[model samples]
Target: MASGDLAVGVVCLSQTVVGLMGNVSLLYHYLFLYFTGCRPRSTDLIVVHLIIANFLSLLSRGVPQTMAAFGSTLFLNDIGCKLVFYVHRVGRGVSISTTCLLSVFQVITISPRNSRWGELKEKAPRYTGFAIFLCWLPYMLVNIICLMYITGKWGNTNSTIKKDLGYCSGEGNNEISVSLCVPMLSMPDVFCVGLMLWASSSMVFILFRHQQRVQHIHKNDLSPRSSPESRATHSILVLVSMFVSSYILSCLLQVCIVFMDNPNILAVNASALISVCFPTLCPFILMSRVSREPRLSFAWIKITKSPKPIINM
Candidate 1:
């Protein structure tokens, strides 16, 4: 391998390790909370599942890509390729779905008492449970095509086949199947992105009205203290923005790679690195809002303040 490839390999390794650690930390901390008899909120439940999805994405995609960077591109077998790619796609879908669910829950939680969604607040837990359950089914179904298409072959002859390193090109005979699956792969993601945008915009409107009410009540105070719901909404908005930004950058780079007659290896690696960043950086973004005061003797156990009053609607 070239020195540049080695450097890229090292960087990929570092990202995988860091992402795994962050997701694992969040998962362990929440499981500990469960063991200690503290009730985890609905948001916490969604976060727990999101962390799992992130961890799986890192394992199934990031680790393999890092290995490929180190010149192990052909190490995987057909079955391994299918499984890894399937899990990676599903994990990504789940992460998107869970984030959308979280945003919608936050919007409902903070809506005005007479608003339509606000009345649904009391049933949030049940709805959350249902949504979480529903999130996995479509993703799992959509990626089933991987089993038939993905293979581990070095020089695949089919021009129409999609080539993922360490995986074989998808078979071309099933063009119709591929066409149907294409929409399945992306429709849910587009839908979730739409939901996130809607929720965040609604949040800003609610916050504006709230600020107006507060200003009317206290004429002298220009900087009204933000409610926890507002803070949570802001945090969710930032996270969604980060997710969308990373996805768009990665997609643009990928399109560039496809058009280039001879795409550089380092450029491809950079695209791979950028693609998985949402899972890698999300936990730290969340940790930024956590309380710094130590709540436990254990070094890893930083107790974050509870989310806004979600139950009151």
Candidate 2:
């Protein structure tokens, strides 16, 4: 293998391994909390859904891309290519949807009781499961088109019309189909990204107003520990910012790939790497926030308020 290929393979392998481990550990933590009868926060369910989506995204894209980077070819057949691409698309969609949901939930959660959003605050948590279901449903149904257009390298007889994706090829002969599918696929993403941005901006405005109130109330105090709401809002803002930046870069790379007559290996590899950044970094971001908040415990052995007497033994 070429040294460049080796380097790319190693990076992809590292990302997949790291992202999988982070997401699995985070998932286990949440499941443990649920089984132990710990009452989870309203946003916890949404977060769990995000973790699952991230896992799927990393697994489906990272593994194949890594193999291809390492000079592996014709390893996947027709069915394999379709399944992998479909799963990646669905996972990517779900991730965006869930993140948007999480941001919107937080906005509702922190809204003042008198504001218009106050009504939604009471109802949002109750429908979180339904909302997450909605997130998964659209993508699963929409990305099924991948099954028709995507094929493995060996299955691609017409090199002139098919776009080679290293291990898989996508039929590009029908401009009508491409035009329709691209917009159909991208519409949901665009909507979700817009909502996420709006929510993030709302959060920033709320946080700023809140800070002014605090500073006015305590003029002598130069600093104060932020409230849980403030901390959570800050975390979500960070998450949203990272996701938006990564998503934009990935989309730009994808557009380049789509427009180019023949995209080079480096461009493809860079796009794959950029696509997984949010998934790989998200779990760590959440974990860090959880660690900083002592109230959100992840203790293996829950401590009781009252102990039994030892004299009987």
Candidate 3:
């Protein structure tokens, strides 16, 4: 109601709007070029999947929260509440699944043959869909309870609204929010996030080992071409790190907010929202390694030394 509160709300809402649009645009361009204009390359498919995941997350969470923050009205009714939270919760959970699949697929693709790890690579595609399906199925079930509970009830003098709109449980009830629903759904949340954490850790460790081995392999005789496999791992690993880092930090902030009972909500939202920007940064990180002129020079020299490739193209 105060001027200061309105100012804070505007600033926080603006950050989410700008970050979401910028990242989505960057990712869309990359996906367009990769899928249609550019050559069919090795990492192209995986990157496309990553773009889809982040884009979904953006639309689901970023858009709803941004609208609520900026718009004159809140979730107008129960249906609106369910719509916003469902998109936010379901899409958020999907990110964990998508990241985990991205990690495992990278590991399997890069694993040395003759090792047990190689077996997984053979079955990668079949398992990827199954993993994504399993990740989504539980969220769907658990959030059914949430759908019933999360009504767009108004706040009063006795209880409070954090910013403008009110979510259910403003007037908290032990049996409803905590005892019956939160406890039940939290079980699945823990399992899903924990599995993702374990998978991400394993993937990161394996990536480091692979990178170290490659260090020794790099030499005069080693060709100018970098292993496209390692490059894929690098991009996915950056994505995982960015997601995990921002997520863990936000989780910590959430815990502190619980204990401290601070009125601030926007900071927590901003932190999580920034996590969406990782998709935009993903291509730039990959492109940092790709040299435009050197690639051009390589093509020129390749033609000069051997012109047959030009005729083939």
Candidate 4:
């Protein structure tokens, strides 16, 4: 293998391994909590869904890119390509949708009791399962388009115009199909991203107003400890900001790939790397949030010193 290919392969491998480990660890913790009869927070369910989606995204995108980088060729057949691409798209869609749902749900959870959204506070957790089902259902149905357009390396040999995606190829001969499919796939993502941005902005404004109130209430105290709501909001904002940055950069690289007559290996590798950043980082962010919660410590047991009988040491 070339030196550059070796480097790309190593990086991709490291990303896949680390992402999978983080996601699995988080998943196990949540599952353990559920089975052990601990009552989890309302957002815990949503976070679990997010972890599963991230796991799928990393496995679908990272593994193949790593293999291709290490100089593997024609390893997958038509069915394999279709399945991999479909799973990746589904995972990507669900990740965005779940994040949006989490943000909106938090906004509802924290709204003032007299406000319109306040009514949802008691009812939101009841509908979390339905909301998650909705997030997965549409994406699973919509991304079937991938099955039609994608093919393996050995398939579609006669097609003169195709987009090479390392181990798989996208047949782009029909202009009409390309035009229709691209928009159909992208519209949902754009809509979800818009919702996330709106939700994040609302959270920021709410936090600002809340901080002002705290400062006013504690005028003499210079450093008031933040509330749990503030900490959770901050974490979500950080997650959303990271997601947007990575998503935009990945989309730009994909656009470059689309416009180029032949995209270089570097561009393709970079795009794949950027696309998985949010998934890789998401678990760690949430883990930090979980650790900060006083009632939900991950240690599972508290160590306390015992009193010794009256013998002077």
**Top-lDDT candidate index:** 2
* Candidate 3 lDDT over residue span 1-313, tens digit each: 5554455446545555664565566566555554333444333454455556555666655555545455434444657666766766666666666666666666667777776878876666656556667767777777776565455643334344222222322223334455566567557656646766666676678768866776766755556555656566666667677777766765565444333333255554554455445443554554543433144344445556763554454
lDDT of 4 by residue, 144-255 (tens): 9879877889645756546788888866556687678778888888998999999999888877877777776677777667778878988898999999889899889987
- Please tell me which predicted candidate would have the highest TM-score against the true structure: 2
Residues 207-300 of candidate 2: C-alpha lDDT, one tens digit per residue: 8877887786567767667878888888888999999999999999887777665677788889999888889999998887776765445333
> How many clashes (backbone N, Cα, C below 3 Å) per candidate?
1, 0, 0, 0
- In model 2, which range of ten residues has the least summed lDDT? 297-306
- What tens digits encode model 1's per-residue C-alpha lDDT throughout 60-174? 8788888887887877767777888799889988988888888888888889889888778888877777889888888998778668767765544556665444323344444
Full-model lDDT, candidate 3 = 0.56
Q: Is candidate 1 or candidate 4 better by TM-score?
A: 4
lDDT of 4: 0.84
Per-candidate local distance difference test = 0.75, 0.85, 0.56, 0.84
The residue-level lDDT of candidate 1 at 203 comes to: 83
Q: Candidate 3, after superposition: displacement of residue 70 in Å?
A: 3.9
RMSD of each: 6.7, 2.8, 6.2, 5.0
* Minimal lDDT window, size 10, model 3: 162-171
Model 1 residue 282 lDDT score: 86
Clashing pairs in 3: none
